[model samples]
Target: MTAPRLLVLQPSQSDPLAKLGEWLEAEGVELHLVPLKEEPAPASLDGYQGVICLGGEMGALDDLEHPWLADARRLLSSAVSQSLPTLAICLGAQLLAVATGGQVRRGPQGPEVGVLLVAKRDAAGMDPLFADLPFTPDVLQFHSDEVHVLPPSAEHLAASPKYPNQAFRVGSSAYGLQFHIETTPEIVLNWAAKDPESAACARPTDFDLDFLAEAHRDFEEVWQPFVARFAKLVRGELSPAGCLGTQLPLV
Candidate 1:
């Protein structure tokens, strides 16, 4: 059987796939990364079985400053409409929201940072990607903006105290995560150093090497298998029958 090929759109150089890539590759999924800043964004999803849009430092609405954002949004809209297996993280999540008739804005509750937990909504219990997750899963939050309103077609999945739209799904296979599951300690530290204001919003202990290290361990325990399952869904090893009776082809 051919390994499932996923197109990973990296909106920022700092936010590479990191541990998420390791986990997905371990599950036998092949990743092809496209750094939108350096290369042209693909106009179509012709050859890939899955798409993953990573976080970025820019706001989702800043299309004028970052022209690639417009292209990225178009691709996300296409992916969701086609029922392609897709995952959007952080800024990517906000982009997904806006691209699909949702809303995103500078978070009114301020930047949500640090290692935190998000509670799953009732609908998450039936979601293909979120169903198996713990009631409250560990995730890393570092964004200044939030997806305030989900798209018309989205099903709410998870929420934190400050952000109501932590995770959501559109169509049958596309998911948008408001938190970071692809970060490492080094990546967090780099984000902290670059954006001190957002870093200051976090608890003082959040930056401690020991504390961050332990948090990452907890994150791995919960999210590694979640990513593996996503890979399986992309490869057609699993079915999403519970999520509106949709089933992917077994490749």
Candidate 2:
């Protein structure tokens, strides 16, 4: 049999999708990293077993600024129509929300950054995408906007203190998480140092390279198995043990 194809929609120079590509490559899956910013076409998503949408600096509402946004939304809508397995992170999640008739707007108060706890919503137990995660997981977050409302057919999965719609599942297989489960220490530091202005605005004074490195180490162990479980779900191997409860730190 052929390898399971995973299509990644990448739109930023940051290349955060590389982290997920590395993980999926190790699992012997066929990976395709497509930069939608350059070539935005709905046909690009064809023949992929699963789709992952990576975060970018762009806002979902700014379709005029980024013409690719419209194409990406069309692709996501088609993916939903087919019930294809999909995982969206950060800005990608916002895009998914907007494409599926949800609202993506600036937070009522401010941005949510650093590591924060996300409480699983009522339908989380039945969500195959969230398999192996705790009802309350301390996940990495960095976003100024969030999904305020979900589509009529979507099921809420997880929420953070700052953002109630942190995670949602649409049409069973398509998942969107506002936090960054694909982040590593290197990736976080690279973006932080490169974007000094945004960093200054979102990061607290105590949020230094050292802090990010330490958090990366602590979260990596928890995130690895989580990704593994998600990959398994994409491959259609959903078992009972795969239904992950809330993951708290091991003492």
Candidate 3:
């Protein structure tokens, strides 16, 4: 049998999937990194079992200035049409949104910076990937724009009270997360301090790198298994768990 392979599209020099990549590696999933900003999008998704696009500092619609975005969106659109397992993180999700007949714009609520709790929607119970997560999983949010209109085919999965489109799954294998599931403490600290807009959105004092580290550990305990499940889905070793109801977290 062929080993499970996923395409990782890196859109920025700054943001990368630090922890998520590590967890996926431990699952025996092979990763193929594409520096999409500097190079061209792959001509085809032929041999890859799955695809993942990480966040960037830019908006999803800035295709002209960042012409590569057009290709990135096209790649995501093609992946969904092919029904390949895909995980679009942060800006990637936004790109996926616009690619799949959805809309994204400057969040009316402003940038949702910092770690926040996102509750699983009732529909999430039936989702293969999200069903096992906590009622309110801790997700890292550092985006300025939000997914405004999800494609008609998309099913809402997890959501934050403030941001209703925190997560969604389209087709059988395509997933979109408005929050960042993979980020290091240094990344968040840099975002909080260096980004003039993100820094202005909230109280910088609350950034608290030490506290963010603790929060990230909370994220790992919940999301690492989640990433493992995705790898299994890609390998076809496990079937979608489907709806199992709200699982009680181990004490």
Candidate 4:
């Protein structure tokens, strides 16, 4: 059988969707990454089994700065409308919420950084996407804005101490995660090197190479299992056994 085709909507070249790509490649999944900045209008979602939106520095409301955001939102809307299995991370999650009638706004204080814990609010009786995860799972995070509310029809999945609206599901197949589950040590280091501001915001006092290395190590351990879980969900698997077993039916 042919591997599932995943459509990756990327915002920029510098911040490539690293961890998601890594997970997909390891799972033997086929991916077609369409840089929205370059190609604003996506062709169709018919051939693809899932869509993965990567994190970006741009806000969901900043269409003037990054025009592609509008198009990306439209694509996400279409995907959700079709009930395609979709996953959004970080900025991508904010975009999904915005596109689905939810609101996205800046936090009252400032951006959230470093490794944090996300608790499953009411995911116990829900679908198997979050089946085996601990009630509260520690995950890496770096974002300024948050999803204030979920779409009327959406299901709240997880929350963090810092942000209550950490995750939600638009439909049975679509999910949005506020934390950066798709980040790897290499990717985080690359991002920190290119964007000094994010790095500074992350570690205000001691923003240096050594600090970044240490931070990367701390985050990697927290990020790995979440990435593995997300990969299982993408493959329509429920638990570790399901992930280890042959891939499940697409639906």
Best by lDDT: 1
The positional error of residue 58 in candidate 3, measured at the CA in angstroms, is 0.9
Mind giving the per-residue lDDT tens digits that candidate 4 earns over 1-251? Answer: 67778899988665576766876777767889888877755657878878888888889899988988988788788888886778888888988999999999997657777655778876534556665567766676778889988887777888876678898888666788888766656666666677666566664533445665665565555555655655566566643111112456998
Off by over 4 Å in 4: 193-251
- Candidate 2: residue 172 lDDT (0-100): 59
Give the alpha carbon lDDT tens digit for every residue of 83-144 in model 1.
Answer: 88899999989998899999999999899999998999998998878899999998999988
lDDT of 2 by residue, 88-161 (tens): 88988999999999998888867677767799887777665564577677777777888989876788888876
lDDT of 1: 0.91
Please estimate how well model 4 matches the true structure, expressed as its whole-model Cα lDDT: 0.74
Ranking by TM-score: 1, 3, 2, 4
Error at 58, model 2, angstroms: 0.7
Candidate 3's displacement at residue 124, Å, is 0.6
Best by TM-score: 1
| Model 4: residue 20 alpha-carbon error in angstroms | 1.8
Tens digits of per-residue lDDT, candidate 3, 44-82, equal 998899999999989999877898998889989999888
Better of 1 and 4 by TM-score: 1
At residue 37, give the lDDT of candidate 4. Answer: 78
What candidate 1 gets wrong by more than 4 Å, as runs, is 241-251
